[model samples]
Target: MNAERLVRRMIDVGALRFGDFLLSSGKRSRVYVDVKLASTFPDILEMIADGIAEKLSGVEFDRVACVELGGVAIAVATSLKLKKPLVIFRKEEKSYGVGGDRIGEIRKGERVVVVEDVITTGRSALSAARRVEKSGGVVGAIIAVVDREESGREFMSLLKLSDLIKAYDSFDTTKS
Candidate 1:
């Protein structure tokens, strides 16, 4: 789980893009990190899982939780690697068939770590954490693959926006 290599891989796969984009959190930014793209490539996904697993070392957690969509693959891979139970929070509460806002159950007082593919304002990850808390699970930590740095919230991240920019610059330089 080398950071540089991971950034380089992201660059190669076009996961990191620079453009005017609107984030799910409703923030506008010139940088858009599409880690979901990594999910389509098993090797890239594995690398992310490896990096996340490495970061989780020494952190005590009973369940790994994540919001639906972007974080699913990363969370599933991490859960598999760490042998931890997975709890997935839905984007919205289900209206039918055992209606609920989440999949899997969290035992009372269980320590949970919320995972996110990218964090801008940290809304999605924090929302998932709040859900965990409401379900009697303690949010031990919040982790992300990339942090846009637009949000002042503190969270563990495998890469930062600056790191990606640096990687992109280096990559572009080599290409020229």
Candidate 2:
């Protein structure tokens, strides 16, 4: 799916909002992209998966890893599309259940690609990558549905949805 189409669809589904908002990074912003809203619609979720899978077409990865909370659905869809295993990393290791920071199986030395919904500081994504590395998995890349045009480009390689954000901004301006 093209960025323009995805942007318009996100707007229609109320996934993209404008106004003052506090971000997870403790910053204020005029625009907020709540990709979690898209999870309610299977079609949109599939579209997102398709878009991400297309972007990763030539990339080599043994597994798709997602940071907990936001990245789960998209990662699941992408994993299904690419026919790869899905690995989930939580913010912290759980004391109960499997009793680890990760869910699902990831073999040591396996190449992994991380998926995220929106990236502002890239802290969480980087942290997740570190966790994967600690688990002996190689982090190949980090992909996000939206990048807030903030910091975090220095250390990590990020594939972002710039065209989609541009389309959304243009659409918002026209509406205003």
Candidate 3:
């Protein structure tokens, strides 16, 4: 599907909305994508997974990763569909034992495909990728449901890794 139409359907499913909203990373936005809604619906969930899968058909990568909390579900779903390992990155060190930034299976030098539900400021995915690198993994690319165009992609590229932001269906990120 075209990016515009796919994004519109996301909005129709209540996954996208417009407002002056406070984001998880404490930024304000005219729109928000409640990415959790994507995974909850099997139909849309498959669409999302297939969407990313289509994007990765030839790109060389091994594992899929999601930022903690919101992203883990979609990451797992994508991994299942693609039949690959799904890794996870934690927002903060677990207060319990270990206190590690990574919570799932990731090996050093392994190629990683990072996944997220949405990107507003985009700092969260960056943090997760850094942690993944520190753990010896190479973050090959990043993916997400909504790209609010709020500095996330630039930040992702700044990290020197491949990046793909499925921009929110409502707006045009291609425009200046």
Predicted structure with the largest lDDT when compared to the true one: 1
Model 2, stretches more than 4 Å misplaced? 152-166, 169-176
The count of backbone overlaps in candidate 2 is 0
lDDT (Cα, tens digit) per residue for candidate 3, span 98-163: 876666788889999888887667787887788778878998887776565666244221111112
lDDT of 1 by residue, 49-126 (tens): 999988889799999999999899999999999999999999999999999998999999999999999998898988
CA lDDT scores, all candidates in order: 0.90, 0.81, 0.70
Indicate which candidate wins on TM-score: 1
Residue 153 in model 3: lDDT = 46
How does each model score on TM-score?
0.96, 0.89, 0.79
Query: In model 1, which range of ten residues has the least summed lDDT?
Result: 167-176
